[model samples]
Target chain A: MTESSKRSRQVTFVRFALAVALAGTAGIAWMSFDLGIWDQSGPGPGFLPFVEAIGLGLIVLAGLPAYRASSDLLLMPANVTSILGQAAVVAAFAILMPYFGFVAAAWGIVIATAWLNGERNWLAMLLLGGGCAFGIQYLFAMLGTTL
Target chain B: MSTTEALLHGLMLALQPENLMWGFIGCFLGNFVGVLPGLGSSGAIAILLPVTAILPPTPAIIMLTGIFYGSNYGGTITTVLLNIPGEAATAITALDGNPMAKAGRAGAALGIAAIGSFVGGSIATVLLAFGAPSLAKLGLMMGPAERCALMIFALCLLAMLLGRKAASGMAAALLGLLIASVGIDPVMGMPRFTFGQPELLDGINFVAAVMGLFGMSEVFVALEQRLVGKITENVGPIMPTREDLRVSVKPILRGTVIGSLIGMIPGTNSALASFLAYGVETSVAKDPSRFGKGAIEGVASPETANNAFANANFIPLLALGIPGTASLAILMGGMMMYGLAPGPFLFRDNPDIVWAVIASMFVGNLILLILNLPLASMWIQMLRVRYSLLAPVIVLFTLVGSYSISSSMVSVWTTLTFGIIGFGMKKFDLPIAPMVLTMVLGPLLEANLRRALTISRGDFSVFFNHPISAVILVAAALVLTFLVLRLIFARSRTPSFDSED
Candidate 1:
């Protein structure tokens, strides 16, 4: 286990823990504001949600030891660039989806992804992206959906 | 009515042209997706769920069931031909089937697997037809508290089966429960986790979640590998010799029995059953050393178990309205979409539809056997296609599939987000199955727990009051204790992380 790899693993673990904690906190806060603590019907709908958030927080706190122990053994830096790039593309697709129709948005996303992944063939990319969008549109349309 | 009479009625309903057409379509599409590595019935069914809204209830359920079992049959094709287990359930088949392919006996391996699966599936279907009513009656006796305890037991059992690192599995289950809480609370009609979004008031659609987790994730992985240009091995004719058939009979019988029993338990899917069957067969075999080196029995047992368990998994869902696997969960969703509920009353009220589904399993199994044996050589040729070409198609389908889930752009985003998370998990060597299990089972656990607590007037002792529930809870506790003890002991015996592989 190299020092750099260990550091990378630590970072990943920290990020994961932080994300889980933030999500849990948000869930708890939402429950507190959205639903009362108790009602005549024993417990409100938010009771389980609140408990689940607390459980998640506990798990995040508990993950520290395992994360530290395995940090050196995991983390391959070679794939970091590609993985992060893929994540960026996914985030962009998600952000753009609401603005564009599913077909246009997905087609653009898939083509951009193929280009980023080194598919330089213009005709091939268009065919692949366009064909998929059309086919799915047809299928969904037949099923009475307009995605 | 006797089982035979019911089956006859089922056959009559299944043979109808409308139902038959849907069954065939589902089987065909299911096999197509199953042939792709890493995708399984869950992904295929989730992707197709929204389409069922337009279908009549019978055809919808029939198609969904076909996709579920068809994937079981199709997964073996890649394992035998390319040595790549399409799904975890087919992992054992690759040990021997791939070796047989390498030894110029690909035909024999594929033929035997198909035949074994057919036999196993047939027996399991017969068992389900005869057994479901009785089991359903048993479930009917359970009250709200008992049902909640039962759900807990199922979750605990899932954690146990996941083994060793139980925390990750439980966390994943908790996550699922959280997701399940997003919709209007059934008990109070109050929005719990909806975040004031009307779209979420109805809840995060199961179809979307499943599609994102299984289908989209697979696409991302496929892209990461740049799977194009990879060449597959040459395949031969597809026909099993008499010797192959003779050797497989006993293993098939054993696998069918084991698979059927395991499938009856909620959360223990075909993958676990196949793995367990393989382990049992290997241990009981005369020569255990031959397992990874190409044991025919290894291929036969797991393949048989996979198909058998796929058929029998419906038992709980049909009887108690509790799905045993992710695919079955989607089927339950389909039932709801059709304005029909799946429980004891479903059997009585919709006998034609229920019987048709059961009968179609028999028909589908027969079709799979024939397709696998005669057309396997052709299917094997699929491996020769470059991964690059397939990657684009997968990506395309995934996007479309995710989008179709709710006709909401939000779902597409959700799928993409999960895809990235899935890829990261894969890179970190975390078991993705636990996450899927969590996402699916979490909500059910929460709902049931709350229900039990409410019924008990906030007394936690209610979970242990019922004898069956107490037994299950005790078993869970014992398993957890044993796991902790074993881990502590093993720490001194071994200094390394055990290879889950």
Candidate 2:
């Protein structure tokens, strides 16, 4: 695809994201108002949120037209893989920590992350991951703090 | 107690073995992250913020502050050896530091930088010791109206002065305010945007947001930029001559003054301070052209300036409850986590903790200088650590940090969700610092404004009636006008002007 076309796609994606965010903010504002938003002395619960949501929504709308230009914002293929890989690892680590415990989950994350990013030797990965993970666990443990 | 007496008391507390150990660990890690790319003091602090969730506030604050200044000091290693700056503060050092290294005076260049940082740090800390108390005394006189105005002024000035585009910065600030309003409203005991989730009633965890924004987002950017740096094996002459000291002395003093003053302001940071110091050094030099060609002053001036700026940033944070820079904003978050707010009252309410933190810094700077000189050769090995290997480890730590906050999965989910949002914001060229700072300050702004209104019996004119509040609001209005004009000018110049960062 042309670079300009790639940029247009990214911009459209961004605009769509902004729209969703605006809608979320607006929905929240609506709900806050529904909760009964008036008091004698000053603004109530919904008052500030409503004003803030409108400001953000307007600003997001104002930022929309700027995406209409040719630009170089598309991520390269390798970077996309690397970013997505790391992100997925983070999400998985967050999920696995409850079941596996912090230290074990950490070790797993380290190994998985290292291997994903090209630490080929499984033994080395285990050593490095185990060493770092357990080291922190021990350090915090000694300090009487838990992960 | 007098400043001198309080500092003496603080010294006794900081000397405890456990506190000393934390400081040493922070310094060592500071050097490690400083030599490596991607993570700076702010990132390290965020990733480690949860660790502080369990410790006493004093030691935690000391350790984190040590890590912060130490990282800035550590950043000098790569700049002199390999021309890679760890963060903005050290970028100025690279201009002449790399040339000096190539000229085979790498040790001398590195040595003077250490000296400059130490000198700058000590000077700034001394100023902080004397400065904070006086500033706090003034703050003690302010009513709620004035405090509210001051905070708004701080945020407005920060948004206006710090960014390339004022409108985007303001938008980011507004977004932060909106995000901060997600939980229960403190005044009315009403939930605004919690979506019926009990987890959010307390609000978005600061550590989670910090992890996602500064920590995870950094990983994404580093990956995109393909930043894998190599350490130079041979760093020449690790010590400076008496002649080199003579060359650097004046520049260090000049930088210290410039950096300290800039740091006192609400928005300027060490990066700008270093650049300004370098510019001043070059312009005032007897031989202007000697710069960018291994001039020792080039390294000394900016290095000194940045360390001074880093130390001085705490002045605003401590005295006025305003964070002057991004890292300090995170530090303010750390302060909040400790159940300590950074207002004038903090000085009176938490004198021991505050003074001990200040005293620990003096010790931390000494320890950094004392250790870093011999450890320069050792720190270069840190360069061999690749960003790829580091990225996953950071994610693991970030997960632990997010979970450690509330011991809940919701915090983890919040982090990952914002991690994705932060990634997108970064890729799209938006500045996250403004957003993060505003989020932290936004609730305070709303709370204070409401409190004042409640006092005034619903008079909207109450804000404009008070002199201090009126001036601050007027200043905000002027800043807004500037943003409007800037938008108009840019729009006239280009078809799509207002949309960018």
Candidate 3:
């Protein structure tokens, strides 16, 4: 997409994000108010959170209109696949960590992420990835802390 | 303990093999981090924060600081060679540093920067050694009201100085407060926004948030722009000529003084100090035009100033518990996570931690100078490593780091979530530091303010009633007014700062 159109898209995305943030903040403020904001002599549990929510809401509101017509978003063809691929690698690691343990889980993360990022030589990847995983495990062992 | 005595004790602690190892690691990683483009000291520290969690507070902090000053010292090499600033603080250095490379004095430029950084860092550390104890002692004298006011002053000042847009800074800071309100209230034990998640009962992990924001986002950006920074080939004669030293020494000293003072201020970022030093040096020179043409002073002044600014930034963090800049803010947060509070009570309550950290910086600076001197070629090779190759390593480290925190997936998931948010924030140019700073300081800020009010039976005027508190509040108000006026003027001149400014 064109730069200007790209910018407007970002602006729109930001506006939506801000609006959601506002709703969240306003909801919290209402809940805080219900929970009690003041006592007989001083501020209550909800007082700080209530004020904080209001402050956040106001700032979101202030910048709401400025984003109008800035640009429409278009996905850049480059690197989008790689970014998603990297995210998936992380997700996979998180999912596998409990079962595989630190050393095994690290091996999966290292090999997968390196492969995703275009390190195609399997032997070389194993040396780098396996060595890295073993290195990390060794470090943890030395520290007497389980990863 | 007296400053001298504490420092001596600290020196002993820092000299221990474990602490020395951390110092060496911090410096080594620091140089590599600085040599690479995009991620600065704050980002590096954030990613590495969890790695140091297993260590004691003193050594953990010692390593974090080594990463910080080491990055400042190492950032100069890329500027001198590639003309691309390795970090924001070195941008001004590139203006003169790159030209020196073109003139085939790349080694001299790099050499002078090393010497300047060493000199600047050493002097700043000396100042920190003296200033921290005295200020901490004064901090000991302050009441809740005064301390609250100081926090307010720092937040306002940082927002005004650090934010590209005044409104965005203030907004990010407010958002931080909201984030801080998430877990159980320290005063009442009632959850604010935990949403019944047992994991968040204690609150969002500061290190997790930082790692996601600074570390993971780097992966995203690196993916977008595949980085392969230029290598300075056959970097010749890594020594400054005697004549070059004569020309540079005075400016280096001047830059150190200028950067030292500016850095201690809450919001004068290191970049600004470097630029200011450059401006001052150029203006004072007989042939000002010689600048941007490989003038040794051009390389010397900014290099010195940036390191000076970096080392001096620790003063506020260690002395008063207020982090004016992002890097210091992260270190301060990491300290808190390590169970060391950084306020006035820090000196009295944890003299060992305070003293050891100071002594470690002196050692860190010495190591950085030595590392940068004869070992620069090795450092440069690190720059040649592609971002694609680096990405997997970071992902692995970050995953392990997040999991190591609580030995649970909760922190990892949280960090991953934040990484996406941080990447979005960067794309939108929303400043990350203010959010992180407010998160770190939020609970304490609220507690202090509440305590002061309680002391006065809920009187709003208690803040104003205290003389010191009154002055600080007035200063915060003045800064707020200045921000408003700046916003008005800037809007009048341009449609959007992102576009026009």
Candidate 4:
């Protein structure tokens, strides 16, 4: 695809994202109003959030028109596989940390990330990953923080 | 005690072994991260904030502050050697720095940048010393109303100045304020948006959010780009010629003045300071054409300005409890985490921590100069470390850092969630600085607004009634009007979508 066409697609994606955010903020404002914006003493807990959410929703609405006419490229397309792999590894690390222990989970993340970044040497990846996990664990222990 | 006498005492405190050691460690880590591409000082500092919990407030702040300014000096290494700016603050340096490297004058560019940064930093620290106490005194006079107005003014300026578009900036700032209201209300003891999660009662963890937004998200972006550094320039002797020094003197001074002045403003940053310095240098040079073609003045001016700006940014944070940039916002969060309120009362309550931190800046600047000059080649070799190897380790560190905060899975999950959000925001063209800055200041803004209202018996005019608050609100109104007008004019001038098609 041409560069202009690519930018157009990105712009479309951004508009969709903004719409979602607008909806989210509108919902938040409704919920905050339900919680009460004012009380006898003064402004209640929900006051600031309600005000801010309304402001966000309005600003996003006003900004949407400008974005429709904008040709500015928001994001460049790159290696999708690598990006997803990295995110997946981090997510997996978070989940596994509860069951596998910190070191094991950490080591797994390191190895997986390195592999996704195109490290093909298995021995080097394992050694480096293991070393990093133990090293981080040692540093945290020295700080008296239980990982 | 007088300012001079207190400074002397602070210097003595800074020279102590533990303080000096932490300063050195901070500088070392900062330099390491600065040499690496993609990861910035904010991210590095965020990743390390939880670990600093072990130390006393004084040394912990000194270490974090060390990391703060130390990264400025470190960014020049990659810029001069590999033609890649290690951080946004040093991006302008690459214009001439890379050319110098290609011409085998890498040493000269690197040397002048270090020397200039040291000089700029030292001078700015002196100015900060003379200015901060008076500013803090002024801050002490502000009531809750005035303080709230000031925060509103700052947020308005930040939203307008930091965002690509006015509406986007406002939206980002408002999002930040809403997120900040998630926990139990400080005044009413009523939870706002906890969603039945006990962990949400305290609201999102600051360190976790920062680590996710800056550290983990940055790694994800780097992965997508497959960023790698390749150093192709030969670094000659680590010294600038006498003629080089002669040409750079005027630019250095000009850059310092510009940096120090811009640094005091609440919404501006070091990156902007450096950019302005570069623009001034190019405009003033006898042969402006020499810029971007290996002009030594190009490297000297911006590098100096950014370092100067970094040191000067401390004034607002220390004095008025307002962070001037995103990184300093994190530092402010760190200060609050350590049980030290950052505003005027902090001077009376924790004079030792305040003075020691101020004194350490002087020491840290000197340490950076010494380390940068003699150790230039050592830092250059760090460029050879591949990103493939580095990314995983950094991710591990961030995860542990987040987890270390309150020793729970909640913070880790927060980090991961925000990391994705951060990346998505980037792709959507929404700048993250305003979000981060507003997030840090959100609770304070809320508390002050509530206090001001409660004091006035829910009078809506309270914000505009007090003299100080009225003046500040007027200024905010003026800024808001200007931004809206500019946006309208901008839209009128642009070509429509149908025309493009």
Among these predicted structures, which one has the highest lDDT? 4
- Candidate 4 C-alpha lDDT tens digits along A1-147: 997788788788778877998899889989999988898889987888888888888888876766767656547648878888888888888888889988899889999999988888888889988999899888878876777
Which stretches of candidate 2 lie above 4 Å from their native place? A35-38, A70-78, A145-147, B102-105, B482-501
Error of 2 at B4 (Å): 2.4
Residue lDDT tens for model 1, B1-501: 776888899898888899888888777777777777666677777666655556888888888888877776777777777666656677768888887778777777778888888988999898889888787777777766666666666666666665555665566666666777777877778776666788888877666666666776666666566544322354555776677778778888999999899888876767777877888998888889988766778888888888888888788778877676667776776777676777666777888888889999998887777677777765666656545455556666666666665666777777776666666555665555545544544555666677777777777798788886787678767866765665567644532211111
Question: Candidate 3 docking category?
Answer: medium
- Model 3: how far residue B123 lies from native, Å: 0.9
Candidate 4: which docking quality band? medium
lDDT (Cα, tens digit) per residue for candidate 3, span B1-501: 677888999999998999999989998887777666666777778777777787888888899888888767766776777766745678778887887887778889999999999899889988989987788888888898999899999888776665346677677778788788788887778877778888888999888888888888777777766655666665678888999999998999999998899878765577677878998999999999898888989989988988888888778778888886778888888888878888888888888888888899889988998899888878777767655566677888777777788888888888888888777776666777778888889999888877887778788899998898999899999998877777777755532211100
Docking level for model 2: medium
Expressed as tens digits, the lDDT of each residue in B1-501 for candidate 2 is: 889999899888888898888877777766666665656666767777776666788888888888788777777887777776656667778889888887777788888888898998888998998999999998887777777888877776665564455656667777778788888897888876777888888888877888787777777777667765545555776778889988888999999999888888765567778888999999999999999999999999999988898888888889888887767778899889889999798999999889989998889999989777887777766666765577667777787778778878888888888887777776666666777787888788788878888898777788888887898789878876775676566654422111110
User: Candidate 3 — which pairs collide?
Assistant: A8-A70, A8-A71, A9-A71, A9-A72, A9-A73
* lDDT for each candidate structure: 0.71, 0.78, 0.79, 0.82
First chain TM-score in every candidate? 0.61, 0.80, 0.79, 0.86
Give the least accurate 10-residue stretch of model 4 chain A, judged by summed lDDT.
A68-77
- Estimate how well candidate 3 is docked, as a DockQ score: 0.53
Better of 2 and 3 by DockQ: 2
Enumerate residue pairs that collide in model 2.
Answer: B107-B237, B107-B238
Q: Is candidate 3 or candidate 4 better by lDDT?
A: 4
For candidate 3, the clash count comes to 5
- Enumerate the candidates' DockQ scores in order: 0.45, 0.57, 0.53, 0.73
In terms of lDDT, model 4 sits at 0.82
DockQ of 4: 0.73
lDDT value for model 2: 0.78
